[model samples]
Target: MPTFTSNTAQINFQTFGDQSNPAIIFSNSLGTNYSMWQPQIEFFKSNYFIICYDTRGHGKSTAPQGPYNLELLGEDVINLLNHLEISKAIFCGISMGGITGQWLAQHYPDRFNYVIVCNTAAKIGSENTWLDRANLVREQGLLPIASTAAGRWFTDPFIQSNPTIVAKLSNDLGAGSPEGYASCCEALAKADVREDLSKIRIPVLIIAGQQDPVTTVEDGLYMQHNIPGSQLFEINASHISNLEKADDFNRAIQKFIV
Candidate 1:
């Protein structure tokens, strides 16, 4: 476990495989930690230097209070790279992580060789929706929202067949830090990068979940359309498509990065 200070945050991150290999930094989703990227480690470690980190306010990282924005989240990654003496690497992110990826791709183009964004959107949901969620979490807590959020994570069939997995994920969501989750909600609510798409000059791969209701396929399509020469691919799973369709997701990433 490696740790670094990023502005107001203390971030926890880890690396795998050889340092000589190309680095691929991974950012976690909103509630989950670096563990969310477990499915990718073994497959990529042999060929690439894998970097996985718990995002600010999640997992072993500090849960600083605030109305956090995408810029702050992006800065966390930049600061982490600076601390590690890493000049550049490939970036792959999912959900909240994906939004962070977009911010970096637009704002820190010099820091990445390629970018991969999965199950995310330019503007996730309306500000009011996230405000409502932040209020609910503040008043009641994550337990009340965990069940609903989990439903949006995986398809009904997958949930029915993988009850244990669903339960575990729901528990993870329920156990998230209230202030962390709420602050991220504020970040998501305020993020709208539709104008920033053209700023992505490097190669990009956009992955969408065919069944994702949280960030619809249309959202991914919008990014694909706006980013010049970007490619869009679809997975049969839901929001957490990487877990639900690990083999396909891994294969797509392996091929694209090569």
Candidate 2:
């Protein structure tokens, strides 16, 4: 694991597999950190160079002031790639991480070969809702929302059967600095990339969860419709489909990347 300073933030990240392999970057959902992509890391590491990082405010990465924006998050990844001397990569992300993938695809098209966006929308929730969450998390920490977020993340059956997995994810999520989480809340609040999706000319794969309350299947459809050559697939899970249906999730994208 290494830390890359991107502007004001020191991004914490881990790389897996051989450096000679083609690079592929994975971004986590808002609450969790790079460790969330462990399953993907283990699966893809042998064939593709895997780079996973903790977004600002989560994990061991630096969380700056509140009210963050998508540009900064996108730049953080770009800077990290620059630090490693990687010209471009394949990017995949879930939830808020998907939002970051969207930003990079549109604004820095030269930096990626393709993007896989999972369980995310061009514009997530309302600004007011994000503002409220930011205020609450800042005052009371991530514990309060962590419980509710768990429900959105895992289906009931998975939660009951995989208690240990649920508990560890919840811990990694709630462990982040409140200020960092709140700042990301602000970023989500202001992030509305619906109109600019036309700018993303690269190939795209949008993954959706049938039971995802956070971002519905329609959200994935919207992205698919907007991105010219984009494709869409759905799984029977919640927001964190990658975790609940790891094999299917990994299999769906293998065709495209391989």
Candidate 3:
């Protein structure tokens, strides 16, 4: 793992495979760190240069004070690319990361060849809902949210069958920085790209989870309908579809990128 000092924060990131290979960056969801993309790293390491990073307020990345915005989150990826000296690469993100991808494709279209957003929406939840979650986490810490995260993130059968995986992600959320998480919650509160979707001219792929309660398939369809020529691929999993249906997720990526 390595660190890049962006103008606003220090970003923690890891790279795999040959740098000469075509680049592909993976952005993690909320709560989890760059490690969430382990399955993707293993699968794509041989063919693509994989870049995975912790968002400003998650993982080993430095957590700045107060509320952050989507522009800041989107810029972090751009800064990482500038540091690596890669002109353009494929961008893939899930949840919060997915929303960041939308912002990136809208604002920095020339920097990416393709953008893949998974398990996310143009507007996630109501502003009040996100603000309330931020307040709760800031006051009572991540325990309450982390405890119920599994139910929101996975289907019942997956939770029962993959207790170890579920527990690890849940526990990681519980141990995450409350301020960081809360700030990101605040970011989500104001992040809405529905109106800007039409402005994104680059090729885009939307991956939706059929069973995701957080960001439903309807949300994916909305994005597909908005973006000029975006494609949608649905998997039979929940919020964390990449983890739950690794094979299907990877296949989708391969199909789109190839």
Candidate 4:
């Protein structure tokens, strides 16, 4: 694992495949780490230089104090690119990471050839909902949230069939840094990019889980309608579509990037 010191946080990341190949960076969701992208890594490693990193405050990354914002989150990726000396690469992210992708595309259009945002929304939940979650996590810890995460993350059929994967992710969420998770909740609280979506000139692909309850297909449709020339792909899964429908997810990415 390699670490990059970006501003106030030390970002933990791993890279694989040939350096000469086209680069593609994967950002994790809110609770999970870069390892969540294992399926994507294995699928694309041969043809692409894959980059996966834990967002600040998740996985091995450092968690600084107080609430964070989208600007800080977006800047972390830019800083990581500069550190790797990568002028540009393909960006793919899910949930929280997906929102970060929007910010990156809006602010640093020159640093990416294509952007794929999955299972996310321009504004996400209302500020009150996110703030309440942050407060609850800070007060009671991640247990309550982690215990019910599977319900929100996957469809009932997927949960019943893929218990191991679900358990691993839920367990990881349970053991994550409370302060870090809370800080990100605060970031989501203020992250609203609806007004800025039309300004994004980069090529974009939006992947929405047809069964996702958290960020619904409506949310994905909103993004697709607003982002100029963006395409939308729907998968038959829930929030964590990449894990529940790995083949479909990979195929969508392959079709969009090429």
Q: Please give, for residues 117-195, the per-residue lDDT of candidate 4 as tens digits.
A: 9999999999999999999999999989999999999999889998999999999999998999999999999999899
* Worst-scoring 10-residue span by lDDT in model 1: 164-173
Task: Write down the RMSD of all candidates, one decimal each.
Answer: 1.0, 0.9, 0.8, 0.7
lDDT to native, each model = 0.89, 0.90, 0.95, 0.95
- Write down the worst ten-residue block by lDDT for model 4: 1-10
Q: Which residue pairs clash in candidate 1?
A: none
lDDT of 1 by residue, 1-258 (tens): 778888778899999999888999999888888887888998899988899998888888988987899999999999988887889999999999998998899999999999999999999989999989898898998898887877889988888898887787788888988888999999999998899798789888999999998888999999999998888989998999888998999999888989
Q: In candidate 3, what are the lDDT values of residues 11-95, reduced to their tens digit?
A: 9999999999999999999999988898999999999999999998898988889699999899999999999999999999999
Candidate 4 matches the true fold with a TM-score of: 0.99
What is the overall TM-score of model 2 with all chains considered together? 0.98
Cα shift from native, residue 26, model 1 (Å): 0.9
Lowest summed lDDT across 10 adjacent residues in model 3 is found at: 1-10
For all predicted structures, in order, the TM-scores are 0.97, 0.98, 0.98, 0.99
The Cα error of candidate 3 at residue 38, in Å, is: 0.8
Q: What value does the lDDT take at residue 182 in candidate 4? A: 95
lDDT of 2 by residue, 1-258 (tens): 589787688799999999999999999898899888888998999999999999987899988765789998888889988988999899999999998899888998998998999999999999999999999998999988887777989899999999998999988777778999999999999999998888789989999999999999999999999988899999999999999999999998788777
Error of 1 at 256 (Å): 0.9
In candidate 3, the residue pairs with backbone N, CA or C atoms under 3 Å apart (3 or more residues apart, or in different chains) clash, namely: none
